[model samples]
Target: MNPFDPTVHLPDELLERIRERAPIHDRDNTFPEQDLEELRAAGYLSILVPAARGGAGLSLAQAAILQQRLASAAPATALAINMHLVWTGVAKVFSDRGVPGLEFVQDGAVAGEVFAFGISEAGNDLVLFGSDTEAAPTADGGYAFTGTKIFTSLAPVWTKLGLHGLDTTSPDAPKLVFAFVERTDAITTSDDWDTLGMRATQSRTTRLNGAVADAAHVVRRIDAGPGPDPIVFGIFSVFEILLASVYTGIARRAIDLAVHAASSRRSKKTGAAYSQDPDIRWRIADMGLAYDALPPQIAALARDVDERVDNGARWFVLLSGVKHRAITMAKHVVDQAMLVGGGGSYFSSNELSRLYRDVLAGAFHPSDPESAHATAASAWLGPLES
Candidate 1:
């Protein structure tokens, strides 16, 4: 009955340890330093790297399964670690596609270096397609990034930042340059991550005032937003799937807790458990019904990615669709769980309450509801009247 029963190499005890610390980190608004450390010790950071590269050599589907399990224990921790996995997963995608670039990413993961995703910028609805940051080319062919990156997860201890910027000074003009910048004096993490629910992510704002990436680390220079480039496809495909997995895990945890609460909480008038009530049972069944479609969908897409199955132009729609569904289902299931949990679930301290808050974050992630709808519509019905 446990969806997290898939043992994808993540130890049960390690998960429990992380789960035990989730509340404290959430309450104190601190990064899960110890959780990260334990994960590192477990070799979790390198799950996507090839075995030859000193990693577990797990496929994207396997990693997704593990991520879902991790999220169930600690959603914030799962989300924070998602940034690191994004880079590693990207590296795996490149390797599979025979792209020479991003091997350094795999190597770094094997070395236990934490890589954070820095693609987000204020007013940049394009996600990976556009960047507000300036990628000033250094005389030596590297880049000096100057701009503000919002929602930079793993802020407290990221060793390298995987980000992109606009190269306006180049002959091409406005090409998005991808590279990695090591943590340095030029990079500053703003103390401004006070948030609802997934507070433990500590995805603080990072101001890169001439944060430098050497020429060697500069990987791609491509046109941004909806391209056939492997780099773009790799990042988008891996990111959305893993992100969906995390939220799916949160949904699972919420339903499990609701089941326990519904069974134990008694109705004063009836002198019986609330679980006996048909409405409460129906709510739980509805939650399960919404949840039933997600895991298989996530797994199938992830496997398709790993197997190099081409969905043609349908890739974006498919990827975004599953992500959208997973998050929406998660939010719906959590809402149902709260209703079934009765008034006690209203308090912030309740686990169900935390799940309620955490699930709200799904709407804000990339390829949000509007974007997902647009993407899917474009795929099925063609573009709207110009």
Candidate 2:
């Protein structure tokens, strides 16, 4: 059976189309342009925007499920689109909290404006803590961002970029300036996207040469590094939860592929299917054991964010932990499938092979294992003693 199916959010036909283009995009190391177009027209870009704002107004719990479904068919497409959704989700998070700062992002989604998250930078382990990009103040009370941003997904076509930088000149020295910059001549995208996997993402390097976010569009100017700001919490909660959903979906698909492989391929000596072998059955069971615990956890935590149930100081730990678990589960399932299916699964053209490569990317996303452990340790045992 096909692992991806029509859900309340995305139609089966849409999933089929996305599935079809995924391979071609991966083969060419190109962005999933077709997938983006389909998702945009399906009103998917507006799923997290408020209903009053001309959108479906989906909860984080609901979006997580839809993302998983989408990811099962094409992890790269799901992951690239995830960047766009992050901004919309952030907008909703603020609106839900009576903060209307990101209302423009909601409005942009309704009008088919693609927003790409651009917080990642070279050598910035601080994540949102700080930015090397310069956020120079303008005479009109806006900021001009001039620095490089890496791993900028949707680089070729994003209409607006949601980014942050360090504002050192202002009296609020070192405040991280969060704003939206429209794509224009000032921004340049590098063609250096070659990678090990998830090539369809085409997350190229972006250089912002005085890319300006006007006064009206600058959203936050809070002190950088981890803080009590709602925007930071909103970004961490939504990004990590949805990220976990994507990798979890990859594992779900790998399990299905393993089951199919076992059922059809016969063992020469026994004259029976691999599925009949006790060892093969056990391997499949192991995959299920790992995959089963994630969805409910993802959904429950997502709902917690939606309902504003305060996890307080534990929020970072919870989000990071879930992300780490999802990636680990996906990689384990793919590895087992490789062994279960034997030599055929080893081919570069094999779906499981591609998945194996794509799953490796999970380790690099924010709140990585070391950071997750550090956050959890700090939450439960306090910071390290000097």
Candidate 3:
């Protein structure tokens, strides 16, 4: 059986385990180490590593489906695993270039190695704030990476590192490199990531003082061109769509919990279950509508991407619009879920609350709703006035 087969890749028993442990993982504010280990062992980590490198060689859409299912089981673990998947895509982009560090990823995945992304930086409110982590040229045609990366998701558990940054001094450099590093070379600090949601991500700060970046560690030297990367555009589209999928799943779960809560608890006045209440019914209907609307939109966008890839066309406007729409839908659906779940929803024990928080992170990612909206608007109004 193909490891990339969506139906077979994510088995029911694995999802059940994730569902069972997610609550405790959230409460403990620790990384979902065990869940990720299971993912690695199951070959889910190599889903995008390319066929040439002994991977499933799945398309972006298939990977998105896996992420959505995983997110439904455990959003925190899903988010961390998404990073690994994204890095795998990065590694594949460089495989033809004979990048060395990626071999470590492939070998590690075969031997069960976990990787994490270090893009966000400290003293910067926005993640991907030009990467304070600097890479200074060394005497031996290599670079030395030094500085701290904040919000480094899955840092404590990750065995490999994928970093993004620019050569600040040489701003006009033609090439932008996304480097890979081993965990043994860097140090992870004890900085806490006790956020309101996705508490189990362990997205703490990691300080990499004098981490060496040899030629082999450099994954890809992307030519700094005018337009966005086609590969990146495809990846971003997948990511945005899956964010909606996960949010929709959470909303469905919330509705289920609400239904149970209402059925068991009766109001004293009319002796009717909460489910029978008109207000509760209305809220549930709203949740259902929001959940129902997402898949069609995602399908339309996925189809557009496939068409673009076939026609050799890059529809930046359409891609950006899809991202904007999906993120907005996710936020709206999650909010409606919270309302339907009621005050008890705020309690940590209520899984809806955790889902609510994790869903919020989706809107805050790179190519978020606001930026996507801007890109769409820009595309609509023609080129910028020089």
Estimated TM-score per prediction? Answer: 0.97, 0.98, 0.82
- What is candidate 2's local distance difference test score? 0.92
lDDT, candidate 2, at 160: 97
Q: In candidate 2, what are the lDDT values of residues 1-386, reduced to their tens digit? A: 44432375699989999988887888888888888888999999999988998998888888999999999999999999899999999888899889878999999999999999899998899988899999999999899999999999888889999999999999869799999999989999999999988898889999999999999999999997889887898889999999999999999989999999999999999999999999999999999999999999999999999998988888888999999999999999999999997899888888888999999999999988999889888988999999
Q: Which stretches of candidate 2 lie over 4 Å from their true place?
A: 1-6
Which candidate model has the greater lDDT, 2 or 3? 2
Residue ranges of candidate 1 with Cα displaced over 4 Å: 1-8
Pitting candidate 1 against candidate 2, the one with the higher lDDT is 1
Model 3 / residue 19 / CA error / Å:
1.4
| lDDT by residue for model 1 (213-254), tens | 998899899986668888799889999999999999999999
Task: List the global CA lDDT of all models.
Answer: 0.92, 0.92, 0.66
lDDT for model 3, please: 0.66
C-alpha lDDT of residue 246 in model 3: 58
- Candidate number that wins on TM-score, 2 or 3: 2
Better of 1 and 3 by TM-score: 1
- lDDT per residue as tens, model 3, 63-136: 66677677778878887777776666555543534434566666566566777777666554333324456676
